[model samples]
Target: MTHVMACIDYSQSSLAVCDYAAWAAQKLGAPLTLLHVLDEEKYPAAADLSGNIGLGSREHLLEELATLDAQRARLALEQGQHTLEKARERTVVSGAAFPELKQRHGHLVESLSELEAEIRLLVIGRVGENSNRGAQSLGSQIEAVVRTIHRPILITASSYRRPEKVMVAFDGSPTAYKTVQMFAASQLCEGLPIHLVMVGADLEDNREALEKARSMLISSGFEVHAEIRQGDVEAALHVYQSEHGIDLLVMGAYGHSRIRQFLVGSTTTTMLRTATMPVLLLR
Candidate 1:
């Protein structure tokens, strides 16, 4: 069965992600999997702590380093296990029935890619344990994971409530149209009020697409509205979200071409960072 996979790290936002994942799982009638990945590259076994040590103590230093590495591995295992247990308990308390817990060791994106087939949706925080920047900047793994995994990802904020109103940033891209259809068909956003907003001066061309999408949602029993504005995408969407009281933002993730891989789309990244509420990215 497909499951909603929530990535849990040592970051402060992990609990929020878990709770939101539970809510999503309940809504979709899918199980929730709390996944914790220990990326070995992020944690080194040993650092060069010996500053100008004499040669006589070099053997002892090497032995000590080996022991320290073993100890670090042990601690990491214990911590990951404890974290998973807590997350499972939290998910159960949050109304998820029989949520699964998993801990893996490797690159997070690679691990997630392998599990993509079984994952219906991915829940992750905007920032992670390695993030040194404030909330304005995203975690390093976010881009890679979003690009690598084909599943829809719910980029969670520090907190989440069941969204009453959802806004779709429509740009007439194929991916965007697919996102609209997915939202209409999927149980994730069913019964929510949806707003389809496009930012551009070319309303003549956008009207047909907007109307089609709006019609689709309406047919699916969604309370749908469409609007068009002119300005920068992120700024326009932010204003609309604030003014209209948007509880969730949904959009297609940027494509993963070589150029895009090297230079991530600024609009998506910036909007994801600046969004006050949760953002659902469909790839």
Candidate 2:
């Protein structure tokens, strides 16, 4: 149950996932696993090809189709194994030692659901092999996992480097506090500079909550810099992240502010599209 599970599909996002998962494996003190799922729906081995034949179709053609289906399934299995081995090698080189490899045959969401209990931190790519890029291209499987899975998800972009500074999009809600506490408990970002930015109307209450959150991190041995910004929450964070050299962004999956808008629906995709840095969405 302490696996730093990384979902890889050999997409452009996959290499980044492996690297981030390796970093997580070191910080979390857990084994790294490169998980590849041969989605049957997308790569069917025995799709029903018997009934939809043309009126003058040859029976031998149906036989040939069946043979091709079997070949496709076999090829998918072989490719999955090859990809897993390559990913494992990449992860180990990134920093993790002796990473494990796993291959499952099913839908992505269902496969993850079965492995939910075993995952301490789940690292996944923002887009899959089917999606072109991360901008407004949040894959359906990612959305399902973010919504249904009961764990922290570290969503990786197509490209990422080791993060030097970390930023938490704080709003002073219960989830926001939990996000801080979760970050404190894990050594994932240990010793890195922290920017606790809250975007909203500059009310005294917001200031108070922000200070409280900062104190918690300070007590946990983190260098903390807390502040309140105006304008859109997601937009402000992106600006601050870029200006401050923040390479990682952390936030609660559910919150009261418009920040939550970036976690679900079309808005989420559009907001995260330009965000090339990885986002740690707390459960």
Candidate 3:
């Protein structure tokens, strides 16, 4: 919880992650750490040889397999190091303070959890290394990371855009209120105008909740545009974004099992998959 951490991989978007992490570090006045994990299952250091072996030649085959696996693991480590170096250089060029480079050999979610206490905010790519160029397909670890890490996560697009106009997708829940408060206090979007949007029936309760959140932001010295849109949640938000040219989308993310299931439904995953702009999710 001392610095901002950005997850980097072999994807081209990893550069954008570095830039975003640098920008966030500048704003929050925290150190920046670039994390690259070499998943053991994906890049094993040694081949499994627990199966029954018959003859002396089986030992030779096992040794060959183990050597090949070790070479693969070494290659993965080298690639990760190169990626981290590039990210660090980019961060320096972006005019932020130098960043700490961290490389691990394990699952991404597990690594993130291990470093959770030292991260104030987590920045990651919308799509993992396996996804295509477009941010249309989500990375495999997106849901798992969302479910495990109880911190602010900024999921970026294929590219980076310095956020100018910020929007918060409010659902009128306690999580939503916490998001507003955290956004206001963090100074992450200190000078940007905020659009507080809720997509649903504009009932009395919704209106009051929206108004309250609006006032809170206003009191924090932000220009607030609060409104309720009708239609599908993702569709409505996209329309509003297109109409106003929102640079970044913000939303509350809860890590509880039930809450995470709901977020996977149409909120976090939908926006991450569809929204072209960077999305900042807070828990």
What does candidate 2's lDDT look like per residue over 1-283, in tens digits?
Answer: 5799999886878888999999999987898888999988767767666676688887788888878877888899899899999898898888797988888988888898999988989999888887765443677667778878889999986786898899888888887899899989888899899999988889999999999999999999999999899997568878998789888988777776455664555334544555768888887
For candidate 1, write residues 49-123 as lDDT tens digits: 556466666866776886787678668978998998998899899899877888887779889988999899999
Check candidate 1 and list the clashing pairs.
Answer: none
Question: For candidate 1, what's the RMSD?
Answer: 3.6
Candidate 1 ranges beyond 4 A from true positions: 42-60, 255-265
With candidate 1 superimposed using the best TM-score fit, by how many Å does residue 132's alpha carbon deviate from the native? Answer: 0.9
The Cα local distance difference test for each model comes to 0.84, 0.83, 0.86
User: Residue 10, candidate 1: how far off, in angstroms?
Assistant: 1.4
Taking the tens digit of each residue's C-alpha lDDT, what string does model 3 give over 215-282?
A: 98999999999999999888899999999999999987753333355455655667777889988888
133, model 1: CA deviation in Å?
A: 1.2
Candidate 1, 17: how far from true, in Å? 0.2
Look at candidate 2 and give me any clashing residue pairs: 135-273
Q: What is the lDDT of candidate 1?
A: 0.84
Where model 3 places Cα greater than 4 Å from the true spot, the runs are 47-52, 55-57, 132-134, 254-260
Residue 8 displacement in candidate 1 (angstroms): 0.6
| TM-score of each candidate structure, all chains considered together | 0.90, 0.91, 0.92
Best by TM-score: 3
Model 1: lDDT of residue 96: 95
